[model samples]
Every structure is written in C-alpha cells, then in structure tokens.
Target: MTAATSVVAGETLPSSMRASVLTGALKISMDERAVPTPALHQVLVHVSKVGVCGSDIHYYREGRVGPFVVDAPLVLGHELSGRIVAVGEGVDTSRIGERVAVEPQKPCRLCSQCKAGRYNLCPFMEFYATPPIDGAFCEYVVIESDFAHAVPDAVSDEAAALIEPLSVGIAASRKARIVPGSRVLIAGAGPIGVIATQAARAFGAAEVIVSDPVAERRAMAMRFGATSTIDPMTEDSRPLKVDAFVDACGIPRAIVSGLESLRGAGVAVLVGTGFDEVSMPIPTIMNNELVVTSVFRYTDTWPLGAHLVASGQVDLDSLVTSRFDLDTVEDALNADKNPDNLKTIVEAK
Candidate 1:
C-alpha cells in the first residue's frame, strides 16, 4: 500500500506533501511525496524552516561531497526545525504540538561509539542530505523522538533551525578546549566561524580573533563576539599567539597559517571540509606540542546549543541574510553565491 493509503491514527493530516528533489547536479524538481508516518519511538514533524548549508550546496553543484555521491534522486536539507504533529508507538502523545529543532542524525545506539556518548562517530550512522538518506527539504519528515529536541518559546523558528550549526560551533569549541581567559583564533567568517566566535566567548574565551578575506564577513564577525578581525588576503603574513585555533575555512593556506599562529601546547580544531588531504608542518606541530584534531559531526550538543540561543548568549537571527520557500530551494541553496549573504533559510510549511 502507498504511504497515503496507510495513514497513522489520531491526526487528520494530509497523506501527500510537496518536496524539492535533487535529480542531479544543478537540477531540482518539485515533486509530490507521501507524508511519512512515524515509526516506533519516532515523531512526525511538519518541517517549518530549513537552513541552507554549504554541504547542501556541494551536493547541488557537484552531486557529491567527498565520497558521498548523489547518483539517485535526493532531498537536500539538514539544518531544520519544525512542530511535532504525530507520534508513533512508545512516544508520549503529549509531545505532539511541541516546537523542536532536529539533530538530523540517526546513529546505531548499539555501537561502541554510542555507548561512549560519541554517537557522531557511530560506524553505521545515517545523516540527512548525505546522498542515500533523504533530508528535510519536504513538508513532513520523521525523526527519532530523542533527536527531536524541543525548543523554548524564546527561540524563533529560524533560530531553532540554526541551532544545528551552533551545535557545530559548540562541538568545535569543546574540542579546542577553550576555557575562561583563553585566547582563540578562528579562521573564516562564514556562518560556522561567526557562530564559533559566539561559542568561544560563551565558553569564557577572553579574546576571539577572526580572520577572513571578506570585509563584510569580518565586520559581521565583530558583532558576533569577535574581539578583532583580520583580512587574510592582506594580513596572511602576520603571526599570532593564542590558546586555540579553530579553522572554519577549508583553505589549506589558512590551516597552515593558523597552525603557525598557535602558541606552545595550544590546540587546533578543524571544523571546515576541505580537500581529502593537505600538507602540514609536522616539525612545527611536534616542537610546539600543538594538539590537532577535527570534528565530523556534533555529538550531544543540541541542548547546549538551544540553551545558548534561548539565553541570548548567541544571536542567530543576525546571520540570516535571506529567506526562500520550498518551491525556491534551488535559489536558497545558491544564496551564498552572493558574497554579502551569510545564511539562507527555506520555509517548507
């Protein structure tokens, strides 16, 4: 039977919904799809807002990001927030009608990584918008109840959707071991870099220096808690000393420069997705005792992300440069082409 023919009990909801499907590179078709029914321990969410991410754009422009390729039709959107409309068995009915921010990852809870609270490293993980797994560029989607984190009234729908990226920033900050009175140097002023600045400050970093090529983004970073800004295009030769370096820009030169800028025993946390491999100064790393690490996806960061947004410690609305609807998801994914644009949101509801 079709999904429309088999409806979940309780809610009088439509069986079919509109979805923006990525048929191939640079091609998106608006297709009607069945509104999915929540399975056991899952919740049916009426997707409201989805934030456009760089990975989504990669999948759109190249049909691939690293090894994950889009050979079949796909739906591309992961940073999303919505309202719970229905609940499956094992979920409390009271959860219905709650506003929530989705974590967008389903990891095998039985894995060793999951047992250690590092589910982001679960070997058999399914992430939204990553080729095979369909994402939230549709009217309704179902996610595990635990991954659907409820947001406070103070967090707007757009902010709730953006909590996903904020979690990324939080994860990077945690990995960098940022502490009160620490100094942090963040390369790149993109959405993640800007958010990382806020996360660092919230984590008690005394100073956050942001380096970027764009003047507008550098200025924007200042408003988002950056103590100072640098134009890497002109100031790439300058040296800096800091407790931690967060590379939000995938550029190789920036990574090398950031490594050079670190003080002895400093930590470097790489958050950006660059090429598969890049050369690094091994001798410098050893001599300085600089700890280097990278983040795949966030692990157990949704609650802190939401709390930061609700408490006004982080301002997400300021980063929203444009808005689009599900029908215009193509435009939303390409919004970043405009250098002035910081972040774009696609409304599915």
Candidate 2:
C-alpha cells in the first residue's frame, strides 16, 4: 500500500515505496523511499521477485566486497524479475505491462569494451547492488529499457530472476569453450557450479564432473547435469583428463587442483571470487599451453538465458529453496548459512 497517482499496467503508480536497506555489516532495515522516475531510454518496472545471490550475502555479512563498501543506506538485490509499468523518452509505450528480467548493469556505451561487444569489461559500468548504486529490493526500479529483457509466458517470475546467475554460467561456458563431446571439470557444487554444469551440457559437453566437499551439493550437481561428482577431500580429479576446468569455488586448493586436472591445451575459466592475489602453478600452465580467463559480470546474456529457460535447456526454478518478502530480507540474506538451502528469493510485493 503506497500513495497512488499515475496509472500504468492496470495499476496506479506509487508516490513512495518500501526498500530493504543495509546500513552496515549484518544490519538491515526497512525504509520508505520516493519512487524513481525513468530517465531517457529507461523503463520503470514494478519489481516482483529478487533472487538472493552469494554476492548479496557477501555484502550483508561484510561491509564491502573488495573495494566496494556500503557507506550509506544502500538497497541490496540484483537478480530480479518485474513488470514494466512506465517507459522513458525514446522507449516504446508497448513495453509497458511486459514481464521482464532486469540485467542489472549499465555500462557506458562510449567505452572501448562496450564498442567491442565486451561491455562486461567496461570500467564505467553501474551494476546494481554495488556501492553507490541502489538495487531492486524495492517495489519499483528503473533500468535501461534495453536491459529490461522481456520473458516468455512459459518462464516463471522466479526463473526470470534466476536468469542473472544463469548468464554467469553461460559466460563461464563460453570462456572455457565447452563444445561437443568436451570433457569438463567444475569445482564446487554451489549455485554457480550447478548452473555451470547445466550450461556445460547445453553447450554440448559430453562429460561434466563437479567437485565439492559437501555430499548434498554433489548430489544436487548430479541431479542437474553433472555426469559424475568428486569429493575433493577423497577423490582425485587429474585422472578425469578433462578438456576444460571451471572453478566456481574460490578455495586456493580447489583452484590448484582444478588447474592440474586440465589436459594439455585445456582452458580454465575462473568464475569464483577469491583473494585479490594468489600464486599459480605457472610451469604447468606454461607447459600445457593452457589459457586462463575470468568472468567479471555478464554481457549480452539475458536474451539467451531467457531462451534457455523457456526451451527447457536450463532449469532455474528448482534452485529455489526459500522465499521471503521485503520485511524478512534479513532472513533471506542469511539463508546461505543453511546447508540444505540452495537458493533464496525475495518478493517485492
């Protein structure tokens, strides 16, 4: 219930809306904020659901992720689904009332990276939930109209929100060049690992092996698409002779082992966040002529991600294990602490 005025999408616009804000480490509070208006080429969306990401939990537990600090009352949520209620100048009015998955990133179009179709590397990117940028843990959010990717009726709101993470998996798969009959090694059975496994399969990998210390996560990986699972504690990975290695777990030991597991000329895609600097086995990488890369954020991925979910190539809804509303966002942020929980979502309504 908020003050209503302009009507769009068969619903009145609100003068103000509720937002879950993070004031400091482990501190969240509900705050009333004025609804924002869309700028040129932007769209105002009535937020429906927001997926709680590992990075969100990182910001919740710590005041910052690396250099991005929470210095003010910052709204925290990036993976989200919503309905477009209003369009800014230069946007088509027909977009209103369309269900969409927000890409949550606005990179400067003038940068060299953006010009080269690698906007994820744009230094001027304004990604949601990052410091100085308010995210979508609110009733309404304004994003570039192009970033508000419409979804098919077959895609649920929860699945739409999950497109964000699935895009990361796609980015990782592309980086590793997972191809037909490719044997892939994925370290970690976390959400990223599970999604990466599916992405690898979709990209035509014949053998997908996931390594995790947790038994349940390993099972979860198998359920999704992993051809096999490895208990990093007891099992060895080098024998797999994988063509590519994707490290979704940032653990140093796992990374070292994953690198060693790769066959000669294999590619290693590092998708997990870890210490700023870590020593690597340079000799092995040099001798094998292996290529190593990292994913910063995804670019030009939402459309394909939505298509994969709609076509049943990827399963996003099954990842959800918990749901909460704006008021209980604190509990949502803490959901990762539970071993049984795979993914948590927050309803803006």
In order, what lDDT does every prediction score? 0.91, 0.91
> Against the true structure, candidate 2 has what lDDT?
0.91
232-334: candidate 2 lDDT, tens digit per residue: 8999887777899999988888888988999999999999987777689999899999898888888889989999999999999999999999999999999
On TM-score, the leading prediction is: 2
Q: How good is model 2 by TM-score? A: 0.97
Candidate 1 residue runs with Cα over 4 Å from true position: 1-11, 236-238
Give the least accurate 10-residue stretch of model 1, judged by summed lDDT.
Answer: 1-10
State in Å the error of residue 96, model 2: 0.7
Q: What TM-score, computed on C-alpha atoms, does each candidate reach?
A: 0.96, 0.97
lDDT for each residue of candidate 1 in 168-264, tens digit (9 for 90 to 100): 9999999999999999999999999999999999999999999998899999999899999889888862367889999998899999999999999
Deviation in Å, model 2, residue 81 alpha carbon: 0.5
